[model samples]
Target: MSTAWQDLTGRARLRDAAIEAFAAQGFEESLRSIAARAQVTAGLVRHHFGSKDALRAECDATVLERYRQLKEESLQADPHQLFTHLPASAQGGVLLLYILRSAREGSAAGRKFTEQLIDEALILLNQSVSRGLIVPSRDEPARARLLILQSLGALVLHFALNPPQDPEDFAAVMQDYYSRVALPTLEIYSEGLFTDSAYLNEYLLATAADVPPATDAGITESR
Candidate 1:
């Protein structure tokens, strides 16, 4: 939040600050504390939101908007007859990190949130297959579970284990890791897993010419 943030209404400013501070520090942080972070007074915090609970609602809405944008961009129906394809580089920002932390704590609200996400995943996957947006699978429920495991699980691991503290540094790392590691791994899974595939063999054959020739001297050294 910088120059453009100056244009926001006081309420918007408070909501943005609440989302950031609460995500990093949890919802128990005081209104005064969030006000300080927002560079506003405690009076304004109450004036804008009336209560902490209302503030939390606004913060949640802010984050959910981010989630909505991601879903809209990622949910492709048909692309050149390739039913399954990777989205254009997935990302999760501060709001996602907060949600992960909350869910892992296993509070009633967190549990509910997790259940909703799982149900949504199941519904979306089942619909996609039923509508012929994706290839039919014998065990679609299992596939959906696997997808949630790989995608969301990787995110939880990254934020829970080790990620850069600085936002810019964190983004740079995500850019590289998602491009080089995460998405490719997903591609391999999307193409294989339940399907009959010779992908590995074909890949090896294509790249075999690049393999270095084994030398007798190296073999003798190994002995």
Candidate 2:
């Protein structure tokens, strides 16, 4: 532990330790082990967090809030800085491991965490759109939700099969993951998937929807 680590209150110490323990070992990791990691007693863990499940919930909230802070800072400074800064953050690997485990575990808390991620992503995506950094969507909320789900779902699958041997290796693994996917992802985002508007036109006609057909750029409304 560093000087800063030594200065934390017992509850903060226990929570930080629990986040590391759960990220490394999974939620089944015991309170005694977490206390040992924190260099605090098991009784102190109970005093602070009440139960293992409660502590896990705290970890979930903390990780999400920290991620939100990082993203907001990156966006406010420069959106492009996210790629350069996020992987280098002190808690980067641990945070990634914690979120990956939470999402893969499929518990009620995990599901809620994913939904909360989508909500945050929606807010941030809209902010980017307003800043002219991202394209506006016809249905903004749905677009944000879909993009969040797609990206996270792909990450979950990729890391589940090819997880880092240790939590500290997460940044490297993420770099490799992004290196492999970046070209294809950027291509699709920039060039688009469809060759033309034939599919959209056909679908609109077939469905006879109130919404007008899409043009070369995107969906357009009837004047």
Candidate 3:
């Protein structure tokens, strides 16, 4: 292969390896192990990625890419039906791993990556607000951050308690909680948050696809 082809192939392999490693072992895994999995030398991994932090960032980006792609596909498919297939536990597990790893390390790379993750999450929440899928209230940004943190906390708690035997279980609980608790609370915060019934329907559909519904029927007594 040409030099350009070689570089592209190497980079692709490195990215794939990094995603697998990060998903499995998180940021604490050794660089050597990641490089080995990629069938590349550590020097090569460093050459392409610059540093361990850079590599971790790249891995985080890859994971986010998966999320973005899923969201886009779901929106395109039947925005209302898109979330039905979501894997709640796996998604939660991966995100939890990233957050915990970053907090534990407190490295510049970890902090930067965590901030980027938070920013992206806020952007998504804001997008939902703009679309009227969510209620718009004071401190929109803060609300978005709080929601993301809550979701993250739920995943962390689930992992600590369950350790995820079946990923679907995680998704089911997440979906149920969001529908009964999260979505209704947001709606109450601002009825104007949703543009129409379609938006609310889509939100429920997508969330249900992503996680399981609550046990007490679709309507929770509190909401």
Report per-prediction Cα RMSD to one decimal: 14.0, 4.4, 11.4
Q: List the residue pairs that clash in candidate 1.
A: none
How many pairs collide in each candidate, listed in order?
A: 0, 0, 8
Give a tens-digit lDDT track for model 2, residues 1-223.
4454554577788898898888778889899999999998899789777888888888888888887886678667754776677555557667767777777889898889888888888888878877877776656678777887787788788887777666645566556665667679978987989878777667667876554344532536322
* Lowest-sum lDDT 10-residue window in model 1: 214-223
Q: What does the lDDT read for residue 124 in candidate 2?
A: 89
Per-residue lDDT over 152-186 for candidate 1, one digit per residue giving the tens place of the 0 to 100 score: 67666776566546543324444534555655675
Cα-based lDDT at residue 184, candidate 3? 58
lDDT of each: 0.61, 0.76, 0.61
| RMSD score of candidate 3 (Å) | 11.4
Q: Is candidate 1 or candidate 2 better by TM-score?
A: 2
Per-candidate TM vs. native? 0.60, 0.79, 0.62
lDDT of 3 at 163: 50
Q: Report the poorest 10 consecutive residues by lDDT, candidate 3.
A: 214-223
